[model samples]
Target: MAAFTDSDGTCLFNLNDGKRELVNGAEAAQALVDKALAGRDHTAITRICLSNKSYDEGAAGAIAEALSKMTSVTEADISDVIAGRPEDMALRVLAAICGGLAGRSLSLIDVSDNAMGEKGVNACRAALEGQRETLSALRMCNDGLSASAMEAVRDLLVAGDVPTRLTQLHFFNNMSGDGGAKALAQILPHCPQLRDLRFSGTRAGRPGSVAVANALAACPAATSGRFVSLDLADNTFGTEGAAALATVLRKQANLTLLSLRDGSLEDEGMVAVANALRGAAPALRSLDLSANDCTGACAKAVARAVASCTKLEYLGLEENDGFGSAGAVKLAGVLGGLKQLQRLQLGQCSIGTRGAVALAKSLEGLDCLTSLELNGNAISEEGMYGFTEALGAAGKLSALGEMDDNNAEASEEEEEEESEEESGDEAEAEEETEEAAADASVDELTAALGGVKM
Candidate 1:
């Protein structure tokens, strides 16, 4: 770890020892905090990281007493604390105490990787509301937030005396469903400064996805090109959701990264999204559409769209088994235009001998190309030989992800396993979606959307 102090009074008090130190009891936690803060000015601390620890109420109270004195602290990372009732209660006590601090205002608060549920949200409400004037980012990933808990968050955002100055909100891998999505949509317009929004793996389907897209389409930040990164991966967007999202994407000129991986955007949905990218999102640096069931036609559309994105550094089109050698050749045709492309992920897209050869030829023009992932693409010995020779001649390729198992002889078994895995994944995803939907009722979503157009 680097020294905490800087010239500008921005200091970090990091207590995260890469999960090596176990500060379990109150005495241990107090001793650790005292030692870490020794010889340091409490009022000058700007950040505190206490991730991956164990604490009871007494330990949390001691930590809170220290935090209360650090009035300048703006960022707090209390993620991955030990999971249990005592730890949860400790977290609540810590948050409540911090919330009561008279002059403290946080800019970023991350409580990710904790199974705190609704009680955790309630405990943090005061702290969140207290910083409505300065809080910028809130990350609560994998926190077991349900639809009602999400609604509680929305209420907190609006209940403050002034609208929150939030710029980033990450709520990934929760069971929020459509109700939670609708709740978020209701609050999007209030967060005019929001730029980075990540709501991936929330089991949101078409209705939820469409609601969010419609909200973004009307959001002032999104319309004014202030939005930059949007990640909605691991959800079931399907065609309708993709179409809705496409409309939003067309308007995001300042967007840099767009991730819609594993969203079930089949050929039709992918084509819609690709068309939206055409002559749009010129500032995009990374675009991920992996496992989207794209084929040669989708690949052609993406190639045409990305040909104009000369600044693109990463393009991930992996796991789309329908994207065969033909698609690879189509993409290769436009590789010459993407001079800035460094990492290209084409793993398991069925790019065989002919496509590998074409890509090898195209590699000659990419001076910046470093990493190329072609794993399980069925490239035979001859194709690998030519590709390796091309890589050696280019001298820019350093990290090549390919194995002997990718050869033709083992490709059949690999493809079969891949197909079976894909089927199983889809079935599991469907069940999860259904379970989430059951948890959140239709009336709840409708009420959350009250008068909001979607």
Candidate 2:
């Protein structure tokens, strides 16, 4: 059963324990609120979770009033509630709730996965307008927010009493279009302290993407080491959008992380990203371009960039069908230069025995690499054996995933035929066969290093 609890694991409200009635109406919500208010110990309850509940406008106002009384509450979660009240009443309830939070210590608010119509957006804006000084994170995912709502949020950030105070903002699965993106981009200059901006599955097309990139590009160098983290995953930002983002990235030299996973980025987009990374953005420590359309040529460009950025520590290139033996070889050539790299994910990239051999050879110099994922590849026992031997020599890897057994067996059979046709000495062939017999699966390679799952 799920329950809301404090930091010490004490349950404040056991929703499914059957000891207390479920909060489905104004009466039940008022009971909880009254109990907390009577005790005058609202600090004991830091999280307000009324998810999957049913209530009315009266309950919402009561809940908001109860929240206003709490002094130490930091997070509020009112998601997925069926408020059987008029739209205007709901708006008033939301407004009251926001008004209550005006001078509180609240920092994070989540009103996601609800049918919060247009008025809900205004309520959110009003709640945030006064709490801008304290609120650093806001999540309104899938709240049926429109471009007008986006514009309102932009104004809240740029024209509010405490602008540039927000650090993280999430707007996933919304209905914002080009106008919304443009509005958000216009406020980027005002929010100089922004750290994380996420917009997954928001359909921010090329025009919208370029607007955001342009705004970010215009920012001065971050006083801190990293400028900000940008996540645009699951958005259909096509090649044009990718190019625009690449241009901005080249200009923004202090960006620490960039994630464009599962986007519409193809080989051309990757080439642009690679160019942006080469001899620039030395502070960039992580880059996630997984599930893109990157191929061997794209991998070659990444290799050049990786060789130039010596401080890069994480690179995720998983689920790309284009990274083959050629890409692996190119990647292997640059692995030695990335001495600080700790995690490299290249799973399901179609790397075969030849590519594995090149990668294993390069592992000889990567002493800092702790986790490597190579699953779903056509790696043979021989190829895996080479990798295990390299890991044993370096003694740094802690996790390695398994390879395709069927593909490994087929490669082994072919190797036997080639061995029989070889014109090498009998003793040498016997020695090689003995070594092959003692070969270990890639999964067993991490037994000596800690047993870590990648």
Candidate 3:
């Protein structure tokens, strides 16, 4: 089933398979054209996807010819046609063909995952200008766009006589730094309908991030609480940028997903973001703040923010090694309230024995949790046992999907050494007492978990 007509009139043509059947672009284009022609109602094809295929200039022109005949294709996903190869000319031909469609008013254009550089942007300039009025979603991720290319995009938007109806814009993994970010920021106000914005892995630093955040704040959609999702992960948004984004977040009452992973937002910045998320984004469901260098110091604030988002389904706080036992305990206190949470990733946060026990206790309340990743948290065998017991007692062990890779088991020699130390000194006796207390707490937690009404 390489090609099929969706129920919503979307003609999806996928040629990405283990075996590359069509040797050249012309063959692929011919096959696509044949598929389209064979459809029950070719004229009703409102969307065409030629993604993950390779094409040359001539084949692109042939595909364009096919598209021109379709007449009803308002959305075209010509992304990844060259498959990471440099096919600037083919892209230009296809983009120009889309722009030249006499009767078509394209609303969505995705050219992502192609090695289209400045030349490709120049080629698509006409198409973007042609579809400016009706273009609602533009995705150009991983296209190797530079700052200069981004400037060209800004110019295209600026030249539009009226505001573009761009509701979603994804420019991920581009080499456009602060200059490009600022360029887009300067023209973002012209895109009043923009809502979903993804600029992750764009090499954007503090200045770029702050500029974008400020621009989003001033956008009509943001002011009216119409923004849906914002993904700025894998960028360098230090304290200043995080603070600026915090300000924008405060106004996003309707925003759903917010991802800022590996953004260099340390404890201070995360605390600021956590504070902003307290009551601002009530509709938020997916939040990713992993690898932000956050410590236990910010866990309380993060917990508060997480508690407020009652509808949250996914929470990723992985790779922050500073969130030790204390942080995990604080976070555990709030996990019970998130009844809608489906996936919770807390891997590599240094949440050791006691923290693991606390988290095990919270599992009884997470009726919807399907995946819980706590790998590399240094949880001991006792903690792991407690977790297994808790889950089994709650009758959710079968429903739980994934819980693996925790370094919990201790070697027999290590256990023997601990036993020897426990019999040696007064200090060892005190340590033994603390261990007993921890064991007692785990038992108490298990008992409490057994009583919870599932």
Clashes of each: 0, 0, 0
Q: Is candidate 1 or candidate 2 better by lDDT?
A: 1
Model 3 scores what on Cα lDDT? 0.74
lDDT, candidate 2, 1-454, per-residue tens = 1234567533242122224333445677678666644454665656666565645666767776666766666767655554554677667656766665666666777777665745686776645666656777777788767778788777666664345666777788888777777877777676656677877777677778667766666643233324567777776666777776676667557667778887767888888877887766767788888888777768767776666666778888888877866677667766766778888888888776656656666666777787888887766767767666765666634556555532565375654454432323223323433432343233246565565655
The TM-score leader among the candidates is 1
Candidate achieving the largest lDDT? 1
Q: Stretches of candidate 1 above 4 Å error?
A: 1-10, 84-103, 160-163, 381-383, 386-398, 404-407, 410-454
In order, the Cα lDDT scores of the candidates are 0.75, 0.66, 0.74
Give lDDT for model 1.
0.75
1 or 3, greater by lDDT: 1
- The full ranking of all candidates by lDDT, starting with the best, is 1, 3, 2
Candidate 1 lDDT, 173-275, residue by residue in tens: 9988888888888888888888999999887777887788778778777777787999989877888788878887888888899999998889999999988
Tens-digit per-residue lDDT, 18-136, candidate 3 = 34433256666677677545664656667776665666666777776766667676777766666634565666655645554545788888877766777788776655666777889
TM-score of 1: 0.82
Predicted structure 1: clash tally: 0
| Model 3: per-residue Cα lDDT at residue 289 | 98
